[model samples]
Target: MNIAELKEDLISYSKTIGIDKIGFTTASTFDGLRNRLVKQQELNYQSGFEEPDIEKRVNPSLLLDRPQSIISIALAYPTKMSKRVTSKKGERRGIFCRASWGEDYHYVLKDRLNKLEAYLQEKVPDVQLKSMVDTGELSDRAVAERAGIGWSGKNCSIITPEFGSYVYLGETITNIPFETDEPMEDRCGSCNKCIDACPTGALVQGGQLDAKRCIAFLTQTKGFLAEEFRVELGNRIYGCDTCQTVCPENKGKDFHFHKEMEPEPEVVKPLLKPILHLSNREFKDKFGSLSGSWRGKKPIQRNAIIALAHFKDETAIEDLTILLTSDPRPVIRGTAAWSLGKIGGDGAKTALQHAIDMEQDEEVRVEITKGLQLIEE
Candidate 1:
């Protein structure tokens, strides 16, 4: 089999199948990534969402037998909404990060990977392959970097020159030995924009991230948001984009290359008050297609309460009071109590006074006290 010719043919086929960028690399163990992951674990910097087995994560051979090559692909997603939602006064909205604006990228990227896998199988009938997207054991950024898809940026995203960091990454490990591409040179010299812009200082330094403090990671947690980070969340209901939005490389990098990645402005930036009352069915009906909904509606609803407080919207006082007084979920009730304090008014104060006595949960009671304290302050 002519391997070089096959590589070129595969690259051409990838473009025809909606893959924005594709690159190939040897399936060698990611030595540098293993060390970094160990350090991150020691520092308690990991988000706990990743595969616990570091060996499986960095060693492609563990995932696929006799893995000879790895192929990385990227699909560009839109940064700006093509259609705009008109803003009306007192109708505060919470924003989802650009990554979660459209259909879940896992499905989108997997479809492309499946096509690539089929193409390889057709050419080499005995080809062995294993594929993964974001939830995969191998780091998408690490594979993409080695495969020459893009350079790893300070924000921990693969920043393609053509697509900036606004890209979804996926990879396939194969027995076929394809020619490799050179890694891109780091273009983030002396630029601290992504690090400096991180709301919770999650970017401890240039390329290192303390995931526990990252708003994007924090937004996914089902528990109560850390008090110190609540104010930092702003109106971000799902993930934080401060780092990517501030990057100079992404200034003019909006791309609408795939229709599946287009945002529905109303759904991505929905009214904050309405989110507070969404039934499970309603939440799924509205946001199930987006990647952000994978964690279910609890975190999103809590963030919506925080967003309402960020706006200090007195209009949402009735909704906040309902949640504070009667919500079955302690996290939601406590978060509502805190938000009511942040959005203090006569009505909020009255609700807090009533809930402090009636609330049974120790944590919820504490939040109610905090709410009352804020009103006094």
Candidate 2:
């Protein structure tokens, strides 16, 4: 088959394999994408992920020199999942932003891409084919935009008329040239809802994001969260979706749903007391397969304690007390002390004193004093 026919076959096969959108482009799409990755790394915008290794992540040549074109694939995750919505009451629960609420999309998308690769190898006989699902050096969004599957929104996400930004992107890099798709135009217009809605002011005047200020990054980071940003975290324990939620483009879509991505029913909106009581083992067992779980339990557990502190619920004092003395991670211990203090009362004062006496880490002790004082009046 000619390149045109090959492109049609690839797109058709991709849809049959469960992908929602498919587009084709060349390796040159890296020009703009590579620049973005480098800029983000230079500004320390990557947060927890190691600085994007420019040479490794940016260079398409490293993966395929004779690469004729790229086939970009998009998977629209169900946006109507019940877990995306949280209660507005005092006992608030956190939601895993749509993208992360399911069986790991990376694995799922990659499996489909692998099948496409197998199909192409059999059809093309000797063409080089490599499959990647958001795990590789190429820019899947750039490819998507060029392939006409979507346009990159001002929020820096690929936006499709059907799926918006609640889609996972993957691609197949191969030496077989495919019929090219047209590039999409920017539809953001004068809309600034996404920028204005960002709680941490992560978005700049235009669309640039300061990863350090991004709550998504903050929730994933390990160890002690910066004191200044703690209150800004609100109740987000995993990632933040305020921008997407505020985007007009996402308004009518169903909330993304995938049971594998959700917390258990009881755990979905547990009281602060129950979360503080989760041992390291329990925390691991509860969140092990989650997309956010790769960083281990300490960061999330600490965030949970922070959320408890944020609520300033007096009922959290007993749980915070246990964590102060029994939790293994020093960050968790210190943050728990801070939370207890934030939840101030006679009971919290007593717990804080107990924490101070048992606390071995100077940081924890300092936080205890600071947190206690926040509600001292």
Give me the candidate number with maximum lDDT: 1
TM-scores, one per candidate: 0.99, 0.91
Badly placed stretches (over 4 Å) of model 1 are: 86-88
Residue-by-residue lDDT tens digits, candidate 2, 1-377: 78777777777887777777888876653666668777887777766464256655555557886788888888777655453445444455554555665566788787888898888988988989877766676666767888788888878788888878878899888888776788888888999989888887898755588878888888888878887779888777778878887888888876333334443433444444555666668876766556766677677778888887777766667777888888777888889888877778888888887778778888888998887787675
- 10 residues in a row with least lDDT, candidate 2: 255-264
Model 1 C-alpha lDDT per residue in residues 251-320, reported as the tens digit of each score: 9889888989999999999998899899999999999999999999999999999989999999999999
**Poorly placed runs, candidate 2 (over 4 Å):** 48-51, 82-92, 255-272, 279-281
Error of 2 at 65 (Å): 4.0
lDDT of 1 at 237: 93
lDDT of each: 0.94, 0.74
Clash totals for all models, in order? 0, 9
Q: What is the Å distance of residue 176 in model 1 from its true position?
A: 0.1
